[model samples]
Target chain A: MDSVTALGLVAAVLTTGSFLPQAIKTWKTKSTKDVSIVMYLLLCTGIILWTAYGFLIGSIPVIAANVVSFIFTFAILALKIKYK
Target chain B: MDSVTALGLVAAVLTTGSFLPQAIKTWKTKSTKDVSIVMYLLLCTGIILWTAYGFLIGSIPVIAANVVSFIFTFAILALKIKYK
Candidate 1:
């Protein structure tokens, strides 16, 4: 793959992967007190929009990153609402 | 601006703005105990690359989002290193 695509992939992996630990923590701890619900809500909204935008533009990188991010972030957001 | 640009702007605003609270928390508390340092390091690296990728593609949305994200994430990272 090209460097651009590689960088996009890297961005997706690291950024998306960054959430894994937190998600696991929330799951294991079952505590969402410290997490900002507003932030997650807005973030999930933006991720969904970006996903649609990516689809409109037919950009795989954008689509791929936001898909994982969408799921992960949504789970976090849902938990925040449920727990907090 | 076009809808594409507007959506991109919205993406940048919501997504990047989401970091403000976290950065402030780390700044005020001077604590990085809850944060994942390795993730931040990798994320910052990816953000920087995405910035470059945006510049290469002449995509303002990518560039703007990443610039703000880079600064925010990096500041958090620096604090993480200093504190943790």
Candidate 2:
């Protein structure tokens, strides 16, 4: 793969990795009072916009990553709202 | 902004938003048993790669989004791992 593509993919990995700890912690604790609702809300907004940009450009990589990301985020969001 | 830039921004927004529900849900419930640790791990890999690509290319949009995304995803992942 080209360097640009590879880098883009790497960025995705890092961002997602950073959040895993929180996800795991929440699962075991059944409590996310410390987590920030605004952060999620803002982050989701940014992600969605990027996903749409990918579609507009007909970019497969963007589409694929965003699709999975949306699902992952959605699951956590639901739990947060429901449990809160 | 140019169309490509605008479009890219939009894509970011959509993908992120899709996951907000899940994030929010997990935050409130403090339970992410249903969420997949594997998925987060893989996603983090992709996001980090993408973010790197943007840096290499000097693309502000990619860098900004991935940076935020990584933090967001990392938070959830941490919670999941810790609590589960």
Candidate 3:
């Protein structure tokens, strides 16, 4: 891949991976008090749209990043609901 | 704008706007206990890189979204540090 794509890939990895710790924390602590339900709700909606946008644009990095982000954010959202 | 770009703009708005509630919650509650610093740290770093990627790719939506996201994520990060 070109450098720009590489940069995007790296950015994608960092952004998507960032959610892991949040998910893990919520899971381990079983505390969703500080986590905003609205944020995740909006986030999941946004991620779905982003995925759609990615497919429409044929951008692999965007699609891949949002897909993984959806998994992580969705888990956090589920935990928020379950624990809330 | 084209439909795909319009979709991206909407996605950008949603994702960027999602952080407001979290930042507000953290600010009002002054509780970072449930919030993961690592996540925000990673998110901030990732967002910065995403901004760079946006500039490189010349995507207005990506650039605008990531810029606003960086502000919110950075604010959250600051709050996390302050409260922790």
TM-score of each: 0.84, 0.58, 0.96
- The runs of at least 3 residues in candidate 3 whose Cα sits more than 4 Å from the true structure, single-residue gaps closed, are none
Error of 2 at B59 (Å): 2.0
Task: After the best TM-score superposition of candidate 1, give how far the Cα of residue B26 lies from its true spot, in angstroms.
Answer: 2.9
Q: List model 1's recovered fraction of native interface contacts, to 2 decimals.
A: 0.41
lDDT, ranked from best to worst = 3, 1, 2
Question: What does DockQ come to for candidate 3?
Answer: 0.88
Lowest lDDT block of 10, candidate 2 chain B: B13-22
Judged by lDDT relative to the true structure, which candidate is superior, 1 or 3? Answer: 3
For candidate 2, write residues B1-84 as lDDT tens digits. 898886666666654544555566677788866566775676667667777677789988667866776676676777779777
| TM-score leaderboard ranking | 3, 1, 2
Listed per candidate, the RMSD to the true structure in angstroms reads 2.2, 6.3, 0.9
**Chain A TM per candidate, in order of listing:** 0.92, 0.76, 0.94
lDDT by residue for model 3 (B1-84), tens: 789988988998999999999999999999989898999988999889989988988887779889999999999999999999
Q: Considering summed lDDT, which 10 consecutive residues are worst modelled in model 2 chain A? A: A13-22
DockQ of each: 0.50, 0.28, 0.88
For candidate 1, the per-residue lDDT at A24 reads: 72
Question: Fraction of reference contacts reproduced per prediction?
Answer: 0.41, 0.46, 0.87
iRMSD of all candidate structures? 2.2, 6.9, 0.8
Give the poorly placed runs of model 2, Cα more than 4 Å off. Answer: A17-20, B2-4, B10-51, B64-84
List chain B TM-scores, each candidate.
0.89, 0.84, 0.93
